[model samples]
Target: MALMIISSVVATPSGNKDISVAIEEMERANYFTFVMLINMVPPNLFQGNVTFLMPSDRSLSRTMVPAQNSVMDLLLRHSIPSPLLFDHLLHLPTNSMLPTSNPDLMLKVSNRGRRSLFLGNVKIVSPNICTHGYSVRCHGIDGVISIEKPGLASPITCPRVASAAAPLPLLAPPSPSPSPSSAPASDPPHGAAYETSGGVRPQMELALTTWMAFVWLLYSKAKLCV
Candidate 1:
């Protein structure tokens, strides 16, 4: 969808500026949430000088994350803490990562040309949502921006808190990790006779005894003849 740029509804630092053009621009681009966020925010809180980085409706719907994840945090990750337009953005090196309010700790930004601005790895389909304000530039991206992981798995336990009541310890920093060693190792059972102690049948024992008797008789006869 082609975004509509409206100018009457926008808020700015100097005075309230008409954002009817940016509004129309965003509407056409299908950035419904971005429009709604701006419209919903308390006018005074966002009334000061600032730039907004907005995502499209499609962008929000495409994430693999659960819905409870704060949409506001994700929005802030895309927005620069300061007001910066494309022309000003040019000074930054390409492939530079920017900081954001999200705990994820980082957001990626790369510019291919005046044509597009990428946020986190997503492509911006439409930028400069409102035509009236030079400070605010809106770009539509293919996906949502990234933030620092809210809670990550830890391989090691964190240090315990110390208190006036505590166990005594006689310890230095733990020694280096133990050297590798070899020993008998338990193996998966794959062989036959896992639990049996003897032959498959008792008949085999009698057969061996009969053969021994025949050999002894032949030996006695030979000795007597000699």
Candidate 2:
């Protein structure tokens, strides 16, 4: 329960000239406790294009204050609904994720360049400290922003759609050639099941010539009834 320093007066809204010149460039960069937590919220939550990410003031004097209804979810988890700057956050490339303004928090970056950037676990340490506000920007981190717990970050993977190769089991067409005098066989083990058994060997030789003409019409009607 420490952060309640107020006094820079920022009630904004004179048609919010970019959040009043980004709260006068975050009070000339002293970042007075993140400009008193952005004057305790409201001003259309810093209207439109944001990008604050403040923190410093010795990293909000060692954290733990946000209460008045969580100060607009602690300035929407230290803003960033777009107006980025520090060279547009140096083309965000390290695991890049960003999207804060609290929609379930995000900001993953970490770029590792300009004196070592970073985001989720803080570190910016005063980048473009609110570039003369063309929609408001800010920067200056080095602590505070730690909310990242969507199952402890780092898991975007998504590119595994190669599963369509299982249709090769239709080989059951070779059971009729067993009647050539009832049993002269043992040579059918070549390759690919005997090359697919010659496509059903002419329908198994027309079903063995109609089963030998119905067994010679029952042996010519038992030799003409004997």
By lDDT, the best candidate is 2
Writing each residue's lDDT as its tens digit, candidate 2 over 63-172 gives 67758667678778888887878987888898678788777767778787889888777778778776776667778877777664442145444332233223233446
TM-score leader:
1
Error of 1 at 199 (Å): 78
Model 1 residue 78 distance off true place after TM-score fit, in angstroms = 2.6
lDDT of 2 at 185: 61
* lDDT against the true structure, each candidate: 0.52, 0.69
User: What is the lDDT for 167 in model 1?
Assistant: 38
Clashes by residue pair, model 2 = 126-140
- Single out the weakest 10-residue window by summed lDDT for candidate 2: 159-168
Instruction: Give TM-scores for every candidate, taking all chains together and pairing residue i with residue i.
Output: 0.46, 0.25
